[model samples]
Target: MPDTPLDLAHLRAFHAVVQAGGFSAAARRLHRTQSAVSHAVRKLETSAKVRLLDRRGREVRLTEAGRRLLSACDLAFATLDAAQEELGQERGRAEGRIRVGATVEFGCSVLMRHIQPFLAAHPGLEMDFHLGHDLLTPLLREEVDLAIDCHDHARADLERTPLFRESYMVACSPGYLASHAIREPEDLARCTVLSLDKAGAWWERFLARFPRTRRPAFGRVVAIDHIRALITAAASGMGVLLAPSYSLQEELARGELVPLFPSIRPHEDRFALYQKTARARLAKHRLLKAYLEALNPAELGA
Candidate 1:
């Protein structure tokens, strides 16, 4: 004999009758007439070539075959329901991992300050902050979703957006300045200068651009490999630190460090967010930009 096809509708109606204990009750639950429900169960049993329900009892009871097949039907419908629930959880939100590459300074300042609000808003989102040296290398290699660092040339495949406005100023602890006279930028050459390891790219650029009139002809340089250590040294009166004004706001406010040549501000590029142009349209990238842009302009001076 040829095999009969199984219709899910017939199987569903049969399962409903078994679960509801009677054809009339199942019809009520399914919003169908009693005859329609009985026909569906009959079709299912005919296809299976077996008697499924013991209808002679006061309440219908499942046959042994019905009990076995009902287990299979329950498993199938349960799997479908679970898949739908998972899909619903993934819908309508930025739900994915963001691997961000940031310079040491940016990781401590802008990145740290902005991350909490975004995470609170998107419970399904995840992030990893790579604060290691030369983060731009990983960004260009596609290892990170975004890069946060000083403005620089990007390859044709990449795009950059400036995050804020920044400038460099000479600063030292109040105790150091009380004794040393730093009326001009050139005066820095006479004072001990603390800077990041290899003197960092920012300090190098600042020195090359400083005017012969205002800048030191030859400055005493102490290179620290860490930004936090550099900040600590400057606070301890180790030397004059040429640093971004915004990053030192807390120190300045608390009188831990004092700025010199307040009138002579050398503006510099703020940290920028960089990503491949191909990823510009992605929801995660757009969401990150939206949150970062909402930062307080007064505090960030963007």
Candidate 2:
């Protein structure tokens, strides 16, 4: 036998193929290209010195050697899951720390509601929440395990799981709109627009809709760094805001804020949960991913 070490990637790729019965199905499940999946499986067969799959037709059939290896893979993955569940941290309690970073709007509008249930279910787990608009700073500094950021950064060391997009519609207190005779996107030029000082992606997208409305007054820019304060200023009739629908649901429902043009959706900002690719493979990291996805299901298309 060759003295090459077994790669977990190859093992996982083989397992995915066996479970999926084909490279295409496994590729979809793993978020990998079909060729990549196939290459990994082929490499596994070579390194293990065994015929792992028989792909003579549309379906792939596991050989005897492949079946044995598949069983081992199943056992290994199961054991890892169990280890995280039972003996995870201190033999009883959840045994890991995960730092999460998110914009304040997500924390207030989406994440807060899900925290109680998640924490109660995983008592041994410890988490630190950092609120900021620049999701990159904490992630680059290794301060957070993962971040809900506005882009799926395509870097060699990072992995991204799409959560949602940052789409905004113009909104303001009903009283404010009633006070101003606003008819179209051009009306924003007169209103004091509240926006996060750190980022202007949402506002930029909204403004881009109107090619000629390129003045600072269109943004009339109140520029609050904190989401809560920004929203509060808008709620108090400070000015109009370009905000995600999720962040303004309660206000809209209560009639405190009304959408200017409900039909106009801003350009989509690709939002995703980002983490170190290798660390994302860990069971605990997978759990965190699941929790965040559950909280933001609508954005995740669930």
Candidate 3:
């Protein structure tokens, strides 16, 4: 549509510059000289007849026009990459690397347990598991092929499928239950609340089900950052813990931990599997997708 056709290489240089945050970094990533990368970006701006970037020393900020072009370039590059991967897969066996992003607890407790059989069934497939708290960023940046996120934010550019709902259970060790009375929801106020944070976020969600007037105040809060450590603390009769049911299956089954509220349903957090919309058509992606979709969290606990 324009008088001059924008060069793909130049556009790539501009994109890399923006992604890397500077010309020097972009040059290193593109395997080109800094001057060369700068020239390519300048050429791209000339072709478009607009200033796409605002350069201030080492820092570069994208202009309004650059933001629009970058979005288009991202889509074009992702589509092209997907097509290339699809073609490569067609010429080879069903084997490749799948970069997966997931939360720490879910990755350790749930995903790792399920991925064993999947890896065994497909020996040729390799899994690059990236465990973190913010998986959405890496997923959007294409650093990860897929992500399992618990966020409720809507992203039109992503393909989100409800993978599972992680339900919570209020539990404590048998000794603690015997020593302290937790007959009703209000009784929780008199007991120590075990959580990952002093704010008692986990217990807050469980208590949200009760009426505002009936909500119990915590007598003491013990914050343990790690899930396993928190579980161990709760198992030692330290305090009451509201944890995901899947993570507490063994303890509950072995009678190491006992449920507090049997009749009241605790909070359930919905987690969804996310992938870039039409990003990859590779067989590895499909295989992992099908395998993950078929898994039942309840069965995993068993």
**What TM value does model 3 have?**
0.84
Where model 3 places Cα greater than 4 Å from the true spot, the runs are 1-10, 16-43, 55-61, 120-124, 278-283, 299-302
lDDT by residue (142-236, candidate 1, tens digit) is 45778877758567667788776667777899998877776776677688878775443546646666665655654677888777788889999
Per-model CA lDDT versus the true structure = 0.75, 0.75, 0.84
Q: State the local distance difference test value for candidate 2.
A: 0.75
Candidate number achieving the greatest TM-score relative to the actual structure: 3
For residues 1-302, write the lDDT of model 3, one tens digit per residue.
74899999999999888877789988987899999999999999999999999999998998999999988997888777767666766766556678999988888888887789989988777889899878887776566889988776588778887778877888999999989977887787789999999888767768888898878788899999888899999998999998888788889889999998888877778888888775645567778888877888653343
> Model 2 compared with the native: what TM-score?
0.63
Candidate 2 lDDT tens digits, 25-49: 7898789999999999889887887
The order of the candidates by TM-score, greatest first, is 3, 1, 2
lDDT minimum window of 10 residues, candidate 3: 293-302
Q: What's the distance in Å from true for residue 55, model 1?
A: 75
